[model samples]
Target: MLPKPIPPQPGQESVWDYPRPPRLERTAKRLRVVFAGTTIAETTQGWRVLETSHPPVYYFPPADILPDVLVATPRTSYCEWKGMAQYHSVRVGQRIAPDAAWSYPRPTPPFAPIAGYVAFYAAAMDACYVDDELVVPQPGGFYGGWITKDIVGPFKGVPGSWGW
Candidate 1:
């Protein structure tokens, strides 16, 4: 991506060769969120997918999501850079995706921007949308940002962008 401020180091490599996401000035326009699939399995906060070698992760706002639908799980994972991430389970109809979503209650300093946040696996969702347009999940079990008309790709999980 054009605005990739730092280049990929040795092992990190990079998925950016096109352009970086638009930077914010602390007051960026809010992108509308839309949920699809059965039971509207989605995060309330608008999530941005940062394309990487790993699967696309959907970041959500704590307040934006329906509170009753989620249940805190005892599971936890630690990321040296991102800090300790907490897990939560989602219940939809007869289906229950346990620990399918995660959050950072107390993230490391650098990742504090994502504090009190949650993320979901793209594959776990039944349906999702942004505005009137529908969203298509990126393959390889990825779910970064919602696919919209404004965004262009060579996106990962779409087709040729696999292994991205």
Candidate 2:
């Protein structure tokens, strides 16, 4: 059973209200990812994917990420709403986060705008910010959502949420 969703305060959004098939929306909020003392990616032209019981997963345009930071891996995964996802390892100097980012190179029609756009796992990064607010990584390693103050949830990656 799904846990009760936290009531959202004014100016906040409940993840329970998000749609199941997921919605991809372009956001003007500044998004930034930092690791190993380097700002790996930052952008205002980012996109966010919202799905039921999950915090928003922000995607950055490939052009905005620091060059040579991402190295592709052979690993891939599939999403019912999106399509095949390709994994990438994030590397900066001697620090590396393996399979810490992913992208859908050829997504479903509705998700095409995010093709080649990258999404990083907040847990693997030193910090991730949305509009200057530091984000809490969504619970569990399997999901890559970023939890900000304005987003409320009994998020899917928490223990006992697998069946949600």
Highest TM-score against the true fold, candidate: 2
Candidate 1 matches the true fold with a TM-score of: 0.58
TM-score of each: 0.58, 0.99
- Among these predictions, the greatest lDDT belongs to 2
Instruction: Give the Cα error of residue 101 in candidate 2, in Å.
Output: 0.4
lDDT of 2 at 41: 100
Among all windows of 10 consecutive residues in model 2, the one with the lowest summed lDDT is 153-162
lDDT of 2 by residue, 1-164 (tens): 67888999999999999998899999999999999999999999999999999999999999999999999999999999999999999999999999999999999999999999999999999999999999999998999999988999888987888999
Model 2: pairs clashing at backbone N, Cα or C within 3 Å: none
Clashes of each: 15, 0
Q: Compared with the true structure, what per-residue lDDT tens digits does model 1 show for residues 30-92?
A: 433322434443333454435433222446667767756678999988866567888877776
Give the Cα error of residue 55 in candidate 1, in Å: 8.1
Flag regions of model 1 displaced more than 4 Å: 1-15, 18-57, 142-164
117 in model 2: Cα distance from truth in Å? 0.1
